[model samples]
Target: MVVYQSNSTNKRSRGFRVRSLSHFAERRVQSQKLPSHEDTYPEPGKSKVTEEKPRETRDEWVISIKDKVNKARGDVTASTWDKLCIYRVPHYLQEDDKKSYFPQTVSLGPYHHGKEHLLPMECHKWRAVNMVLEHTKKGIETYVDAMKNLEETARACYQGPICMSSNEFTEVLFLDGCFVLELFRGTKEGFTEIGYAPNDPVFAMGGLMHSIQRDMVMLENQLPLFVLDKLLELQPDTVYQPGLVAQLAVKFFAQLMPTGEELTKMDKVESVDLVGDNGELHCLDVFHRSLFKSTRTPDGKSLKKSMSSRKQQLIHCVTELKGAGVKFRRKKTDKLWDIEFKKGYLKIPKLLIHDSTKSLFSNLIAFEQCHANSSNDITSYVIFMDNLINSAEDVSYLHHCGIIEHWLGSDFEVADLFNRLCKEVVFDPRDSYLSKLSGEVNRYYSRKWNSLKATLRHKYFNNPWAYFSFSAALVLLILTLVQSFFAVYAYYKPSS
Candidate 1:
């Protein structure tokens, strides 16, 4: 008495009639779409027609196969036409770069999903799924069904074909999605409450958790927002907030953020927020968008660069700028990229350089370069810093100015970090977030008066001893000039 509905207009769904629900087990569809209308019923007394319909002619089979091939090709073409936010780090970009852009401890998406190094985390992933189900009092079927619904669109978000079968893909989505949700909730609420053991290695270990956070923000290792949203909907006893997931993601990675950078936590910006705050492609995208608050856009509204001037070299290094009478001051603001040049002062927000800073920034810059639509603020900032730091002395000068805060043990390491950041990175110096500042800095640097003044300051006014000597010398010279003038007047005017 069981009935299976057929939704496809083609023969695939039309030819199927199941007598029992168990008979439906063998049938599988490549797409996520489910069956619709009920299968046709026979008359009460009619005998079932066991005879098979006439087999299709060879020519008809050939045409049908051709149509399917063409449709698959069309699907691929359309999917590629839509930009996939997640991407492989280009090989050329990886060449000679010492920084590792790939996920090291854990892998979420298919790109690096079963690497030997990442296998250990897989156990925790299963634990996450089990914990989530237990907490919600739901079965594995609920998660599987939820993920299966998003199978096709989620597949489309990746760059190319996922080599896994539909079931495999859905299972991975279920496991990964639950792991992410549970991790976010665990971070917000402790793991013990989330049903993890007190000493659970993945959830409780601080070092592994740090590595996991790093791995999560990588461009290649990302799941789609829709997949996360689907699982978020299934969380029991949770009321939905518009951008709660995004907020959780930001909070999860907030510790890794370089010191003093402000992320606009709003889920939306008025017009320039292209991704909209909550709809970012990945954790890195969320971090990227958070950098857009009150930064240097000419109109104060647009994030787009004006590009009015030709591409110019970066102004000068810290030592060089100091020689050019430019002063370095730390700007007290949350916007990390907000750099300003005025009144002979180059105000840069404080930038903290840690061990993980290079890897984090490298991936973010790579994401910007590979994706056509993404902003290059990070890349531009790195390039800008590269131009301004040629040696350890430059780092020391910036450190003295409160611009660079680092745990790298030495200023030289800080200097080397920026110098190496842009070595193989793709950047247009002219099309930069700091282009306007570069122009202003160079203009100030090129002025003869400023350089001469700086030289005087360095030579005569550099120390208290030098200032005192210069003041005494100036007074002596003035008295000597007065004496000479009086003597000349006495000799010429004869007692007048």
Candidate 2:
């Protein structure tokens, strides 16, 4: 559309084209101005502008959904989903207790590496690598090349994509693996034998070793066992093999065991990890698998096969169990998961609660809950213990029965440890190994005679003072009855 600018007397004199600067100025204004809602350029009905509408809020939503569907489809065939062994702890699990799931003194895997606080350990890690190369008489290339070959496999072990270059990731596996093997060897065979000084900071330092040990077992702070084993094999003439590395691990992490009893039979554990430990993912995995493994004897015979059964959440609290004549005793077994109930007796292997127990159990439970190939044994045990321990009294009773030993401040602290362990976990009650045992305990608890006898014993014979007081009352009542009977007989005879 064109508008003509005309002088007062030039109605048709200049022809319709205004050949002046005013014509150009008018055109610029038309180009710069936007058309109002009422107007459409080049006739509204004649153009496609009528059909072309602006984007609406609903259109954005549709696009977003399409993108999500595309992402979901990619996850279906993504092999990493199944191949993941080392996982970042989900936010829900780690939110409540960051200290339990996170590394403190040292960082092992890529998760916590290079953090501002964890950087001090880097120099120490380099020192460890130097020590490893010096002791094994091999160049760094031997381990570096091995890590590069296993790079893809190592990355696959993690949950998400690793954000490291090939060189960087390989170095991580190489250095971290070497440092871990050295620590394992150092802890067991002495760091002095491994060429470290008597007061070396990491291994020989008293309190620091404990912290490093705790950090080594964290969920996010682990390198793959295959990585460690590959590094182990790369070394020569060392007293290490594919199987004995697990032994070294058990010894390194011996203090993390929940029970103070001779809980781990090193003989039984040596054979189990060959089948299981080669697949043993990380340090946390070694500790987790070693806890529940109680198969094989010195003669190389199978001890007991695992029984598979659906579970029912039937175990009552300790106080309630005691009310039903149920007695608690510490079972003698290396496997902590072995809980047996029979003939009004519920026997559990001794459990020790300490300052480090919470951290260890938290990571183990988190790993079990996150890893797909993992079992619910640890989680089930935690949940079962949480159900059994309702208060300090329950802890005290279990402590008295020799089923629980704790270095914690008090029995209440021990009770709280079990109670808080399973805070944000999801467990199918049917998956608990103790379910059948729990059902039996509940059935026994329902029997009237058992409860009555238990109540009587607990009330009258619970303590020596109570027993003496009840006995005195009973004797006095009997004497009073005898005196009344004599009076009645004498009165009857006098009347006759």
Candidate 3:
């Protein structure tokens, strides 16, 4: 899928939702907060208490427990749904590749806000803040005060805690928000025009820009869009258009989008429909939306049925499907994941795989898996591709047909990329957006006549000698039939 920022990335695998992992961190927090059972029992280093108390009547114990429960309930806060969008990538996902899930250059928001490695970028953030303030002739309070007002609302957007105090948190929102805004502004209007030196390390469209662009889309490294919008509003002479930040975002990040093999250059985004309509949560959401916006979904609806079993294969892999008479063809489109199957032909949009492609898909899938309200479209697309590509041959076929393009060294690497993407994802195949489409593909693959014809074609018509032999044999049979007919006629009519 083409995910653009004013042109940029994030997204998903089919067959899995991250419900199992959502509460892993929460459960751990609860475990730490509540008293440990092991603490109730004597510790190994502590002296063991061997004395037993006199047994209480069941009713008495029940009353004591009821009192304790009442006290506990009074202490506990009632659960209410919180608006959560950004999240830390679960360890299960991070294990495969930390770079894909974690920011490498600049930290956005509070997740990796002040790590020593990321601390270097803090000054650049300040510089961006300074430049914006200087250009607008406003004090830092102009931005920080705005953040203070929206602090609680912004905090709710994050999936977990933001440990910063009121002042500290607001400062982060201002600094990071300003930096993100400047980045978008600088990218769209040219960094030099925004007061950065031509050789300014961070602002220049150079080495750091690529890393920063990739980092910006990490699930944890996103600033709230509201903050960006507010900051953008504060900036003078800014366009007053709705979703202007998102429009600029597409320009800044869209170049990273995967285009078809023939689409060697990125297209300028003329419009960004998703951000204007979907109420984008953050920059990553903008990226995520770009990948899936207005694309055809399976069955034109959400798949409601869960798979009869877990980890079910969506459809036979590419090689097996071909063996079952399915023909692969490239659809003329730039958006990947738009696949269609008809009359044993599977037409898929050409997908160009750049280095950022994996990270983009990883983050987007993580987003869908984490966000309850989000659609599973991205996740399904990745899982669908993973299911189709089993080995190098499958990759080769797709590449040969111009459906899959990659900058990787070989088809093996492309195959491995798809094969590894859906690992450790907890998915119920039938629940995916691609589930209905997969079922249709499987049904087509199941036909005995198609399989028999495919086998015959593969075996006999595959080589010139075999085709020639079959042709000669058919010709001889036709001649013999003619001779037999003549003889029979002569005998019956006595040479009339």
Model 3 lDDT at residue 106: 93
What's model 1's lDDT at 281? 66
The CA lDDT at 451 in model 1 is 95
Off by over 4 Å in 1: 1-76, 261-280, 293-312, 483-496
For model 2, residues 66-110, the per-residue Cα lDDT tens digits are 999999898777666555789899897888789998887898878
TM-score of each: 0.78, 0.77, 0.79
**CA lDDT scores, all candidates in order:** 0.76, 0.79, 0.79
Q: 123-197, model 1: which lDDT tens digit per residue? A: 889888878887888888887998898887778767767899899889888888888888889888887876788
lDDT (10s digit) by residue, model 3, range 250-302: 77877677757332233224236556633337888887666665333534564
Ranking by TM-score: 3, 1, 2
lDDT of 3 at 25: 61
On TM-score, the stronger of 2 and 3 is 3
lDDT of 2 at 157: 85
User: Ten-residue segment with the worst summed lDDT in candidate 2?
Assistant: 297-306
| RMSD per model, one decimal | 20.5, 12.8, 16.5
